[model samples]
Target: MPRVSPAHMEARRRQILEGAARCFARDGFHATSMQDILRETGLSAGAVYRYFPGKDAMIVDLAHHVLREVAAVFRDASLAERPPLPDVILGDSLTRAADLLTFPPSLIVQVWAETVRSPELATVLRTGLNNLVGHWRVLVEAYQRNGWMRPDVPAEHVARTLAACAQGYLLQSALVDRQDVSVVVEGLRGIMSIDAPTTQGT
Candidate 1:
């Protein structure tokens, strides 16, 4: 038996995950079956099973991928060379939010809905959220040190508030498309004292 290269293995795994995401997006996770994923990927049942044991496993991986992509956006924004203004950060946040907002809200909605029923999925989400919050807390503190943000508000409070705001935006956008998110960003700037409202990007 010949060995598969690491790159090939990773590519194959991503292919399965992508197909699963599309299926879940089209149909709620509960409604999506392994066969549906197989059909989406154009892979045989055996091939699909080789990568993911079942639908539950596929959902878990898909959810993690989504969370990680979101988390990376925050982490990158935090680490950028030029410090980002609050409005700029907010805009960037929305842009990232929009990326996850893709067609068929059911993808995210399904995973969110599943947390109540699946302890395993719940843990994955919780851990990913905690890590994201931690990153934001650090960023908030950095902003405070440089007087870019208000010092009166606690860093943890600010981070958690921003996170909550993002989730709220996601929910609203998922329900009704084309919402004017600038107002929300302006409100956040006021709360955080993110100066230079004109600042566009990092």
Candidate 2:
């Protein structure tokens, strides 16, 4: 018997994960069984199980994959030579967030539900959020130091506020059918705008 190459193994894993994502998105995670994934992937039960032992493990891997994609976006933006405008930063963030919607909104709902039942998954999400927000906080502080952003707001507050805004955008879009991304970008710009102080005397 010929052994599968590493690339082939990774491809098989991706196939299984993709199929599981569709299953979870269409049916609630609780309702999506291994059989559903098998049908979706056109793979045997053994093949699917070879990639993931159970639904919970598959969901965990999917959540980690999604979060890593988001984290990569933040990491790239944070490494820019100069801080980008708030609107620019948020626009890029929202674009990355949109990737989460590649499947039905129900997929996000399922992930959130699982987080409640699984402390480990919840911690994974929390850590990802912290990493994103911390990167933003550093960028915000740098912008403030360079007089590119409002000094009146605390960097940590700004970071959390922007993170909340991004999450709110995601939640609203998932809960609703439509979203005006421009509105969100503009709102973030407003929040991070630099203030010009008036001279008391000339």
Candidate 3:
């Protein structure tokens, strides 16, 4: 047999990762095994190891993949707006996440659970989520400079607050028996708005 090129190895790695994500998402990480991935991707044990040395590597990649996907969704929500306010940007984001769940729930939820058992997965989750919040802070500051957010509140504070709320909504939507996205949006709008009649101040 001929040796495989680096590009071929990378492609195979991606194929294995994609298949592993399906398995991990459906069965949870601990329950999944190399044999499961082999069945999912139709590759032999040696073939799988050629791309990923072990199962932890695949899960680390899966955690990264999930974070990248959430970041992309919020990034698209920002780009699609004509002149995006921080509120609209966030609202669009939660709405996008809500829609994504309707089709197939994200692997992020599974990844979060698996992190409890895997230190590498936990580290990936911590680092990736920090980076995501950082990107959001940058976007919030830009919107503040454009007068899209209130001038009094610090952009970083607003960014974290909104991210916390949105993350909570992700978990809540999974549990609750409702489709009240407006509930989240309205609550967030109240948190930021100064003209709310009752507590209108800096």
Candidate 4:
């Protein structure tokens, strides 16, 4: 047999993942089976199993991949010479995430729901959340240093709040109301425009 190159192996793995993502997005995780992935990928059962032992592994890997890509977006923004405001950074990050993921953003809702029953998935998600929060903290600290944000508040607290806002936006967009990401950024900009004094003068 001819030896396969690393690039070819990676490509094959991605093919399986992409197929799996489509199935999971179209049908919930529980409803998607290995046969469904095989049919979607047009690959043999042996080939698919060679890359992933089971659906659980595939879902976990896909979740990790999505979170890592999303974190990288925030990390890059935080390292920029002139980082964007919290709202802009989040909007950009979310936009990047939606574009990068092979599946629809709505699929994240299903993954999040599955976390309740899968401890491994929950742990992976928590770690990913922490990674994202770390990057957000850097941006928050920068804003505080520049006097754009109140210094009295803890940076971690602010970071988590911003992270929560982003998650809420995702949930709302996916479930409650579908709107452009610009709408979210614009709303945040509006809220930040009213600069109230940290302490009222006597």
* Highest-scoring model, lDDT: 4
C-alpha root-mean-square deviation, each candidate: 5.9, 3.3, 4.4, 2.0
lDDT (10s digit) by residue, model 4, range 81-159: 8888887787878788778776776888988998998999999999999998999899988988888778989999988
Reference-based TM-score, model 1: 0.81
Over the full model, what C-alpha lDDT does candidate 1 score relative to the true structure? 0.78
Clashing pairs in 4: none
Poorest 10 consecutive residues by lDDT, candidate 3: 98-107
Off by over 4 Å in 3: 1-7, 72-83, 87-106, 176-194, 198-202
Order candidates by lDDT, high to low.
Answer: 4, 2, 1, 3
Residue 144, model 3: Cα distance from true site in angstroms: 2.6
Q: Return whichever of 1 and 2 wins on lDDT.
A: 2
The local distance difference test score of each candidate is 0.78, 0.81, 0.72, 0.87
* Whole-model lDDT, model 2: 0.81
Tell me the spans in candidate 2 whose CA falls farther than 4 Å from its real position.
Answer: 190-202
Q: Per model, how many backbone clashes are there?
A: 0, 0, 0, 0
For model 2, residues 1-202, the per-residue Cα lDDT tens digits are 9999999999999889988888888887888899998999999998988888999888888878877887777777778878676678778777776765468655777788788899988988888889889988988888888887669989999899878888787778778864777879987677656465665556
Residue-by-residue lDDT tens digits, candidate 1, 77-180: 78976667656666776776567644455466678888999999999999998987887887888888987666988999988877888777767766777566
